[model samples]
Target: MQTIRSINLQKNLGDVLRTADVETVLVTNRDQPRAVVMSAEEFIRLKTAAGEPVPNEVRKSSPTLHRRIADPLGYDTRDPGYVEQTASDALDGQHADEIAREIDKAMRRWRLR
Candidate 1:
């Protein structure tokens, strides 16, 4: 975490934003915690890691989201509307990648196979 005074952030918006894009920055007012400045990507990633719901505004802001939303063969697993097929045993190619994602999610949360 990086600390940036609210006053400095107002003066150095670009530098602060660029830093926040790669990591979280803690914002403070008069040396007391006040707010946080973070990139939407970091915010979404953190939310996913914590099993928290990401806001629609963050989803809509992504330039590539609309294209992903339109992709039928592609999987936007982050989308709340994403559904796993009922026929898991089929192991057909259509949803193979999605199945892999399921495994990945389980491994990340459980740290075990």
Candidate 2:
């Protein structure tokens, strides 16, 4: 809840930012808030704790690719196109079993299994 005029931000940005415990510095223009300056680490920690999705660049650079996808557009989860099946689905029906057997035979022939 720190506020400073735009001119002050330009003059003593570092000092103003250092005064806050949460590192959120509000910049104001003409007595109205215009922008915020905060530490990137703090911002990321807060966003993660709030269950917000990290940016794609952050995800791509991360060591793990297991982050949950956050869709704000309200996608239709019931759509068949959105559903993904596990390998166990290969054993679910006669047609799937036949396909799995063919795949297994091909893998054995190629020494892949």
Candidate 3:
């Protein structure tokens, strides 16, 4: 996924929409993801896979108007609930493979892996 700042999205709506046609674009506000813009076909496939009924208007609208943002941790980085830690914490008492696993874990946790 590629990230685009909210201001940039506003300034280049057409370009952003075009990019969304190829891949998911994460729209960010203050460096935190706020929404996702994907191709209409992908959205419908996702909804169908999830067993959610696709309304006529939604099918017509496709990817626009329907907004979905997922944050499994329940908050963004700007929130006080988010904790920032150093890599040293993971390195302590851990072997090389363990350290690699920890790195992989963090990336997967952020859905970036």
Best by lDDT: 1
Residue 109 of model 3, lDDT score: 87
Q: Write the per-residue lDDT of candidate 1 for residues 19-71, one digit (tens) a residue.
A: 88777898999999999989877777789999999888888732225434544
Highest TM-score against the true fold, candidate: 1
Question: What number of backbone clashes does candidate 1 have, counting pairs of residues 3 or more apart or in separate chains?
Answer: 0
Worst 10 residues of 1 by lDDT: 61-70
Which ranges of candidate 1 are over 4 A from the true structure?
62-113
> Compared with the true structure, what per-residue lDDT tens digits does model 2 show for residues 1-113?
77888987767866876765366888889988898877555665667789998675533322212236332222333222223332334345535555666689779989999
lDDT of each: 0.71, 0.59, 0.66
Q: Report the lDDT tens digits of candidate 3 across residue range 1-113.
A: 88899988888899889988789999999988899999766776688789997666545422212137343323333222233332343345434565576579789989998
Q: In model 2, which range of ten residues has the least summed lDDT?
A: 58-67
Clash tally, candidates in order: 0, 0, 0
Using lDDT, rank the candidates from best to worst.
1, 3, 2
* Residue 78 Cα positional deviation in candidate 2, in Å, after optimal superposition: 40
